[model samples]
Target chain A: MSLAERMLKIDRRIIFLVIGLCTLLPLLYPVGLPIRISSEVRGVYDHMESLPERSVFLLSIDFDPASKPELHPQAIALLRHAFRKDLRVIAMTLWVSGTGMAEQLVTQVAKEMGKEYGKDYAFLGWSPGGQAVIINMGQDLYSAFPSDYGGKPTKDLPVLDGVRNLKDVAYMVSLGAGRPGVEEWYVFGKDKYKFELGGGCTGVMAPGLYPLLRSGQINGLIGGLRGAAEYESLIGQKGKAVAGMDAQSATHLAIIVLVIICNVFYLSLQRAARTQRQIG
Target chain B: MDATILGAWVATGLTLLIFSFLYKDNPLFKLAEHLYVGVSVGYTIVKAYDTVIVHLVIKPIIENGEFALLIPVAIGMLMLTRYVPKAAWMSRYAFAFIVGMGAGLAIPRTISSFILKQIEDTVRPVLSLAGPDGVTFSMNRLSIAGLGKGWHEPASSFS
Candidate 1:
């Protein structure tokens, strides 16, 4: 077979194996490539920075496990930053499947930071109503969440003292994967309540959220794994997001190289076919 | 083994099974895919029952005497009529309630959230007519010029 034909017919599994190796190797032995902090992400960090100590920061965990890789790190990074700032955090999830993961993450991070529950933080857990939940919380916080995840009355939680509704939250950031997430919070929570809102999402959803970011609906945006890496860099605490970036970069590079090689092979084959036809 | 370790092993095994599809179609990949769908559906059903039936309906009506909640509960029960062909017409009440409520909440907000707000941002003068000092240009809130202090700008083609 001609070189072009041979290359074209090469087993796809080989390419898959190469891509897999590229990802695996980087994850095992990281390059620690310098990650540039995007302004959208910095928007969240800076807003968190600008908040006064003990200011109430609401983090709506609006993603499920399907998006865990991209957004879980974001949840962790944001929680870490919030705890570092001594910001009082109240977490809830619009996604039912995400409740357990979000609760565990917050608890784990809070424990690492030596933060007390119901005093330093509170997790309200998941509820059924999507946007209705947001509007309900805005109207009557306790009515929406009669009891927190641990089944404690929200009315009596020291963390929620003097917090009447969404209006009282100093800042709110929804780290979301899909619907009933960042956009719902903006339309139903922030737009009506008028609280300062920020957003974080998987990279795929980041571009869609830029308009919201630019329009000031969300004060900042943290997008995808790279955005998670940026937040980790901003906090000066390297974690899973930082580690994952190396794998992402290596995989992206491998794909790019493959694309170039494939194009060259295709063109060469076309040219060779034309020349052969002319001679014949 | 404890749930955590057990979960880890199951997850790892499933992950490998799914990855096996990278080579070619096989029973291992099919098993993992089916398990994923089953688990997802099961989890969603349990969650719904926990939140809707136990917490919202049962706890309120039985425990707190919030009987007014039954109105919505009745509507929800009507939705179950969907499975009974003859009684399916009763489901209209549920659909109507949902449509009416969803539209009420969504229409004006959709216009403002997706349409009007987008138009405003798109057309808003990024470079304001020159003021006394100079042209008051607005950088993206994430931009270095706009972000101001703490953390340098992230270098990305998009940014």
Candidate 2:
């Protein structure tokens, strides 16, 4: 068979093998490639840095296990930044399916940072109603979440001292994967309540939030695993997101090489066909 | 082995099973897919019952002497009427009340947030060369130039 024909007929299994090797090798070994931090990501870091100690920082975990790889790192990096800065954190999830994961993540991070629950931080767990929950929180934080994730009354929690409602929050960030997420926070939680807002979303959902960012409704945005890596670097802590970047870069390079090879063979075959036709 | 370690092993096995679909769809892939959906739905139901019934309803009514919550409790119970066949028509009352109240609560906030606030932000001056104090042309120029440079770097790199 002609070279071009053979190229077109190349087994997809071979391509899959190359992708697997490209991803697996970088992850198993270590190659720390320098990542360029985007301004959107820097915006979140800068805003967090500017908050004074003990300022209220609300973190909404709006993703589930399906998006855990991308959104989990964002949550961890943000938690680290908040704890490191001595900001009071209130973590909650809008998704019921994500509640267990969110609670576990917050607890894990709090333990890592030696943070005291109901004193330095609180987790509100899951509540029924999506937008209604945000609206309720805006009206009266205590009413929205009467009890902490652990079944203690939130009103009595020292962590929530002097914080009455959404308006009292110094800044809020939503790490979201789908609907009833960042958009809901803006519409129900921030715009009406008038608190500063930021967002982190899976890459596919990132572009939709740019208009809000541009309008200052969302002060910053972190998009996908790259965004998580950028935040991790900013905080001077290299975690899973940073480790995954090398694999991503390697796989991207492999795909580019495949495209180049395919194009080269196609062009050569076209030229040979033309020559044969001319001679005939 | 520790329960945590066993759980980790199970998770890893399931992850690999799911990933095997890259070769081609097979029993392992189907099994993992079914397991994920089943676990997720089961977890969601348990959590909802805990959060909605125990925390929001029964606990408040019993522990806090919040008797007023019975109104919502009654309304919520009305939703189950649909399963009763002959009494299924009664469910409309609950649906109507819910939809009506939801719209009532959402409309004004939606208008302000998605429409008016957006307009207010968009109507601002594009280039403010002059501040309240005076025209600081050099500062404005430097600011604009910096923005331009920052915008170009990422676009050029991507291309």
Candidate 3:
């Protein structure tokens, strides 16, 4: 068989192996590449920085384990920022599948921050209705969540003092994977209640939310692991997102190289075919 | 020996097993897939029951004396009628009420939030020259034209 033909017939396993190596090597070794911060990510960082101490920051963890790689770091970074600023955080989840993960994450971060539960933070966990929960919270927080994830009455939580409804929140962000997420928050929580809002979503959902961000319905957005890495940098805490960037960059470069090689071989094969035809 | 460590090891094994599908699907991959789905569904049910039944329903009604909640409770109970062969038809009343109430609540909110507010934002002036002082460029003027011919030169040259 000709070289072009043989190349075309290359086993799919070889491609997978190359990709695996490309991802694994950089992760094992270290190439510290600088991550450029986009304005969207910076917008979130700046707003969080500008918040006064004790400002009510509502964080909606609206994703499950499937999105853990991307959204988890975003949550951690945001928690770091909020706690660093001494912001009173109210965390909740719309997805039932995500409730445990959100609860664990909030607890872990709060412990790291040495922040007390009732004073510094409260987790309202998952509720039954998606948008209904949000709407109910807007009207009255205590009615929607009588008791938080830990079974403490939200009304009595010192952290929730003066925070009666969604409108009482100074700022909010939803790290969402799907529906009952950022869109639901905007529609049911922020738009009518008139709270400042931001968003963090998996990369797949990021482009779709840009219009909302541009329209100022969402004040800022953190998109995917890259956004998480940027936020981590902004907070001066290098975590899983930062560690994974090397692998991501390497895999991206490998794919780019493979595409270039494939195109080159394709052009050469086409040229050879044309020359043979002319000779015939 | 610790439970957390054991859990971590299991998680690592499952992750590797799932990743094995990259080579080709096998029994290991299938095992991991089924385990993941089973665990997720089981966890979701448990969480939903905790949040919906224990916290939202029983706690409020019993502790807080929220008797008005029985309206929703009764409607929810009507949905359980679907499991009965003869009473299955009765579930339609519950469904109808839910649909009607959902529509009543969502329609106006959806219109205002998704449509009207978006239109309001979109219809605003794209470029406004009006500033606090006068009609100066209200936006940042960091144009490529402002960067002269030597803009591409290294900073070392300027130094």
Candidate 4:
């Protein structure tokens, strides 16, 4: 076979290995890539920064463990920023599978800030109905969730003192994966309740939400791991998202190079075939 | 060792088992795949029972003397009739109620949020529009500074 044909027929496993090495090597040995903060991510940070002390900030965690890596860091960075600003934060999940992770994550961040549970924040855990739950909360917070995740009465909690319903919330953000997530939150929660809302979604869903953001229905969007990294940078605290940027950069470059090489070899193989047929 | 640390080790091992499939499909990969799905489903069921059955229904009836809640509970239970071949027709009532309530709640919002507003944004002039981020920029003055943005630089550094 001609060299061009041989290159064209290279083993699929070799390509996998090339991409794998591209990701794994940079992760193990850190080569910190300078990450530019996009305005979409900065919009989230700036809004949180503008909130006054004790202002109500509700976060809806609308993703399961399947989306943990991408959405979790975004949650952490946002939570840290909220607590740092002394915002009274209330977190809940519309996705049942996300309840345990959301509980643990909010608790961990709250503890790091040395913020008291009832006073500084409340974890409302997961409720069954997706849209109905938001509508119920819009009317009466106590009716939707009588108690926090730990089963403490929410009405009595200092963190939710003035928060009778979704309308009471000053600013809210939904860090979500799919359906019954950012879209549901907007349609059922923000559209009706009139609360200022923001969104952080898996990279795939981010593009879909840009329209809502443009309409000012949502204040901002944090998209996928890259968005998470940008928020971390804004907070001046680099976490797992920042750590993964090197790997992300390397992987993207390797894929681009592989694409170029494949095209060049493909063209050469076609040329060789035409020349051989003509000579014969 | 701490329970948290033990959990971390278990998670790491399972992750590695999942990644092993990239080399070749094996029994180990299959095991991890099934385990992940099984665990997630099992957890979902247990949580559903707690949130829906216990908190929403049982606790309200017992604590607040809200026996009226049983009406909706009965509607929900009618879905189980699908298991009986003869009584399967009864399940439609449950489906009807759910579909009706859902539509009543969703249609208006869908129109306002998706269709009408989307048209507004679509027709809105480019210069007049502000990005969702509130950072307004026009195509005319779009500057492409920091051209490379280190995308090509990182991989080269490792090499």
Choose the strongest candidate by lDDT.
2
TM-score of 2: 0.87
Clashing pairs for model 1 are A36-B154, A37-B154, A39-B142
Task: List the DockQ of the predictions in order.
Answer: 0.33, 0.35, 0.32, 0.32
lDDT per residue, candidate 1, A1-280, as tens digits? 9887888888999999999999899899989999998888898999899999999999999998899999999999999999999999999999988888889999999999999999999999988789999999999988889889887888889999889999999999998899998999988887777899999999999988888888777889999999999999999998999999999999999999989988999999999889999999
Candidates sorted by lDDT, descending order? 2, 1, 4, 3
* Best-to-worst TM-score order: 1, 4, 3, 2
lDDT of each: 0.87, 0.88, 0.86, 0.87
Across A1-280, the per-residue lDDT of candidate 2 in tens digits comes to 9868898789898899999999999999969999899999999999999999999999999999999999999999999999999999999999999999999999999999999998999999988899999989998998989998889999899989999999999999999999889999998888668899999999899999887888778889999999999999999999999999999889999999999999999889899999999999
lDDT digits (tens) for residues A167-211 of candidate 4:
899999999899899999888888777888899999988999998
Which residues of candidate 3, in runs, are more than 4 Å off? A270-280, B126-159
The DockQ-based order of candidates, best leading, equals 2, 1, 3, 4
Q: Model 3: which residue pairs collide?
A: none
Per-residue alpha-carbon lDDT of candidate 3 for residues A1-280, written as tens digits (9 for 90 to 100): 7887788778988999999998889889969889999999999999998899999999999999999999999999999999999999999999989998999999999999999999899998877889999889998999888888888778889999898899899999999999888988997778768888999999889999988888778888999999999999988999999999998889889999989988888888999999999999
Give per-model TM-scores.
0.91, 0.87, 0.89, 0.90
Candidate 4: residue pairs that collide = A213-B132
Error (Å) of candidate 4 at residue B41 is 0.7
Indicate whether candidate 1 or candidate 2 has the larger TM-score. Answer: 1
Q: lDDT tens string, model 4, B41-101?
A: 9999999998889988999999998999999999988999999999999999999999999
Off by over 4 Å in 4: B124-159
- The TM-scores of chain A alone, one per candidate, are 0.97, 0.94, 0.96, 0.96
Residue B150 lDDT in model 1? 34
**How far in Å is the alpha carbon of A138 misplaced in model 3?**
0.4
User: Whose DockQ is greatest here?
Assistant: 2
